[model samples]
Target: MNAFMKVQNLHKIYGDKVVLNKINFDLKEGEFLSVLGPSGCGKTTLLKLLIGIESQTSGKILLKGNDISQLNSSKRNMGIVFQNYALFPNMTVLQNIEYALKFHETYKKDARKIALEVLEQVGLTEHMNKRVDRLSGGQQQRIAIARTLALKPDVILFDEPLSALDAANRLTMRQEIKRIQKEYHSTIIYITHDQEEAFTMSDRIMVMSEGHVEQLDTPLNIYNHPKNDFVNDFVVKHLQTKLNDLEKCMVKDYD
Candidate 1:
């Protein structure tokens, strides 16, 4: 299959610092791809470039064979969910979702219908009447996602979206996001530092360090055959330690 979205020789620089260095990748249609890296590794910078919030210093961004490198964020046909749920505290859940659709030329006339539909899609229809600030962290996150889903963009970018949640909420939202993505048949580029989030949710994972890709492959392939020391240490070893700790807890429980 041809690439649904492609980036070639992407780079971002600030004065003497190189934020993203000659990066390149392809994303298949309806595929879930995660950009995993530690802080200051350019994961978020990559997202900003993809979503058109920031321009690349030099590169091409192709969406379905069309060059969108010069397009603004709204013209890119992409949606992004920030780590903080960017919601209106004063608005109802339904209104929060509907508000965004009002600005969308295609959905504006039917904003209410679209908002209601996405609310249902996120399993938040029952909370539609609640004020945004009144909901739990997970519920608020769902509303943020619902608002984005209302626009029905071609691709969605998630930037550490589950980071603010408690461990239990984070796990639950991970499942929620995966389910929503599958149901929507959505193409996703999820940015995260959490190993389990990327491994469990992605069809493919792109590991980056110091602004360059270390590896990009299926989660199983990455885990079993790391491309280099960075992949082994940053991805595999970290996950292994988590597994070891969990096993020790299980052993203690059995005793």
Candidate 2:
């Protein structure tokens, strides 16, 4: 597993308040890493910094071993899917996907071809000609994903991408996103507050508190072996009560 993205001593501040403090992590190629935390825990801020939407106050970001801290959003070759889907209301499904490729200039002549292919990948080929507003929320989200995929970016950042959907829709989209990432072999950084979603979708989960990373590990370890009291209380919400005799004896001793 090659390191596709790296963050070193990442820090962000607003006025006199620090939002992120000396954060560090590395994402492997073709890996799906989820940032999970409560609201205002800097999960979204970390995603923004990865995609170049927000600059870090200090530290470095490396993409494929190249420093990208100073690179503009478009130059970073990263795609981002926002929580709201961010589809172009005036453009058809095909046109929306093609927009990302327009930066290549040659895309103008072959936009439809590229767009249709991406739409088909996301199971939206039948809706290629339909206006974005005509599609359902789930369909629009697929369109947004297709548009980002069309760019063939090195990394994709998802900023609570499924937060807007209903329970059923969220479940459906979660599977779709997993499928798309596997098919494309794309490195994905997904941010979410939903523990179930993180557990189900992430190759690994990074648990954040306030502005710092408490633990970064596989989902099972994160749930069963949290690093501190905060992680224990915040991340691990439930545990099995099937105690063995020894454990029951320990409880009796405490009592």
Candidate 2 — worst ten consecutive residues by lDDT sum?
Answer: 237-246
In model 2, which residue pairs have backbone atoms overlapping below 3 Å? none
> Which stretches in model 1 have alpha-carbon errors above 4 Å?
none
Tens-digit lDDT track of model 2 for 1-255: 547888999999999999999999998999999999999999988888888888999999998889999899888989899999888899888878887687676466777788888887899888888999998899999888888888788998898988889989999999999999999998999999988889899999999989999999999988778889877777675322323555898999999
Residue 228 in model 1: shift from native, Å? 0.7
**What digit string (tens of lDDT, one per residue) describes model 1 on residues 94-207?**
999999788888889999988888888889999999999999999999998988888889999999999999999999999999999999999999999999999999999999
Error of 1 at 84 (Å): 0.3
Structural similarity to truth (TM-score) of each candidate = 0.99, 0.91
Q: What is candidate 1's TM-score against the reference?
A: 0.99
For each candidate, what is the lDDT?
A: 0.94, 0.88
What are the RMSD figures for all models against the true structure? 0.7, 6.1
Please count the clashing residue pairs in each candidate, in the order shown. 0, 0
* lDDT of candidate 1 at residue 211, scale 0 to 100: 99
